[model samples]
Target: MPQATALYTAKTKRCEARKKKRRMTEPTQTESPDTTPLILDVDGTLLRTDMLYESLWAAAGRNIAATLKTCVTQWRAPNLLKHALCEIAAPNVALLPLRPAVLDLADAARQAGRAVHLASGSDQALVEAVAQRLDLPGPHFGSDATRNLTEQSKAQMLVERFGEGGFDYVGNSNADLPVWSKARRIIAVSPGGTLRHRLEAMGKPLEVVEDRSDPFALLREMRPHQWIKNLLLFLPLLVAHEFGLSVFLAALMAAAAFSIGASAIYILNDLLDLESDRLHPEKRNRPIASGALQIRNAMIASAGLVVLALTSAWLVGPPVAALTLLYMLTSLTYSFWLKKRRWIDLASLAFMFLLRVLTGAVAAQIAVPGVVMAFVFVVFFTLACVKRMTALARDVDHGKLPGRGYGADDFRALKVLAAAGIVLSAAAFLLYAFSGHSGGLYGSQMIFAATVLPLTLWLFRVVRLSELGREDYDPIQFVTHDRIGLMIMVIGVALVILSL
Candidate 1:
């Protein structure tokens, strides 16, 4: 009983000491009377991104269930969650995006001889690392294992240390309103519309940092352009030569379901790939990595999309709903695990493409032949190879180190696979046309010959572009915009409709 009591007493004393240390974090001296003591908010003020969310997703990327468990257990103590995630995910501070204007503001304050300090709700160690990396002067304040120094806590701390109105604060959200109420000068960065209104309600003079992001950043986050790949959901209709309005509507419904499901996967993939995406030349500018959209919003969007996907698939029928669930499960697995595995990632992507065709058949009640399915799979598999090969070859040319399985020399073997895929697809297309099955449905069997011409032209063109190191762009997106690729699509679609 005495030993147990002694252990409890020791733990109580340590906790008290930690709290005392945090309470006394204020600098003993504000340096000079002339110092206005400029304070910077870390997340949305100085950085284009938020570290807490970045860390959360980074940790989640490794082991989502374990991360979720830790977060849930620490929910009652928000500060503990902050501390745990800091240790588990500790963001790549160097790669984190910073606002140029915010940096300039800090620089000006320092040059004017103001005492600059960083204070954030992010973990103490993480915030200090950021301050060090930015070469900022600070008696920095941050959340600890016991206290999340944010909003009210942060305002109270600064008020006690510097007295009301003694310091200037730079902040960006509604959470910063409390701190701003006590600050001498209010500097806001990229505040949302409602936050802007609330900032005005304070009746304090506002200094705004103009946002230069695209207006469609949210839409870009959804990646509607990538939905073009989901048009594969119409392949079964096209191959079966079903042009009835009802069948087309069913295919359209199925397409919508698959596309929405794919978007959810895209958002999830972007979250998991956040760190690596920040290192990539083109991908670094993605909405998530570039901080154009918040991770919380992205998660909510993913959930909503999944719900919509299932609803739409159910409207199509039971078969399509089941297929949609399968696609989502396969894609989630690919995003969490298979994406980093070499050839498996390619195979998974190809299978996803094939699933679209299968769902289209089920949705439209078409009896597409096995040969046609093989053709569709090979076509998409070749496109997947093109996508992977172009990216690796581009990375190698740019002198960036490769990750997620393939190396610099791996693009060559992918090129071979892409060529083999194209050859096999062509063979399948020819076999289907000559089987005398297509002739009974279409006005002319010669339509397949004409359709193959444009497809062959597009496939060979994409391959040559990959060889020339000019295919750095997303192969799917490129098809939507490229002049020749667009022409090929137009010709192919027109030929099919004309034959019908």
Candidate 2:
């Protein structure tokens, strides 16, 4: 069965090549002076654009309030605030930060007297824009709104531009393999998965070029959004009147240190999960998993991140430094053993949230209220539970959780656990608001804050929508964009301010 499957795959690939060949008019035996012979894949090859797409879509949703009439018109919007915010929100992706080595390769190729042709399955306009930015000469090949330049179309374009055995090709996917095979020198820039293994098995003359682990993937693996969980550390400082210049500086430094530390952990996690991540749906694009980033380099980046974080912490204060160390230690534990165990994993995540609150307290040099810490614990625990539930739901939707210790069957139990967490957290909040420490102002404000119940109900609705695949996969985004959720949040904030 395995042999047949592999053979069938190979046959299908061959058929794809034949169709591509049929699409093209014969290439000139003699080349035109203006034509570039070298072809580059756009998405992962020439420039990073996945985050850009995400940002665009996210912005579109955010702009749904503004009622964008057309795609081109949206691009024409004078204010690029949402665009800029999108970059900040998903730096690992939106920045489409170029890989240094690929730039070097392009420079080397250009210097060698080869013309660069940008060919991507993404939109032609995007490809053209990037090519222009990179200073590649005119006439790039890419998918258009009308005709997608993917699969056979991509291959056909390559063949048309560079006759069989005429040009060198650079690419990084199984989808690219059929076309890449047509190149005289096949540069598999970060190749892996079934494609890499199959090519190796076929004894193709392929040279693999990789950057340090993909910065984006490395960044994601670290779950930097979880750094927002560290914002809990800031709440204590905020409540304690630690928002002055010096205190703010300390908090900023602490946040920076934590972000760096988290990024480092991502480098390590990718190194550890290289094989498993490859099988994952979304994670497969990661530098380490895709072979675009080297494991050794990822390790080095990890070390650098730690050193930088600790050094920054030391500059802040001894107490802050100590707290940072604890956070780092906790993260290490989560990475190694905690992530594998079920309830323990969620507990560890909640604990990390609590520590961030402590770190904030240390940064502000104030003792956080116990009630505040308890509230953070409950809130973060609920969020953590929801994350697990989302994962389990995704597993059920997809029929498997290929990279994590989960399966489709776990979805029901996970959802129930998540619901319980939400209930407990809400109860804790209500308890804290009504406690003896709760001042008269706080007690009065509790009525307004009670509005959180409806908000929670809406959030629950959104989460279930996400599980049902209607909401965005990003939880933070889901919260930020859900109309009812955002309005409730605004009301909650108003109540908190009134109490303060």
Question: What clash count goes with each model?
Answer: 0, 1
lDDT of 2 by residue, 120-221 (tens): 765455566677778889578765444556667777767876687677777777877777666676777667667668667645567778743444655555
lDDT of 1 by residue, 413-500 (tens): 8889989988888888878876778878777777765777777778978887876767756776676668877888899888877765
Model 1 regions lying over 4 Å from their true place: 1-33, 190-206, 212-214, 396-403, 442-454, 485-500
Model 2 ranges off by over 4 Å:
1-227, 396-400, 440-443, 471-473, 481-483
Q: Pick by lDDT: which candidate is best? A: 1
Model 1, residue 121: what's the lDDT? 92
The lDDT of each candidate is 0.85, 0.65
Residue 466 local lDDT, model 2:
46
C-alpha RMSD between model 1 and the true structure: 17.1
TM-score of 2: 0.55
Model 1, TM vs. native: 0.86
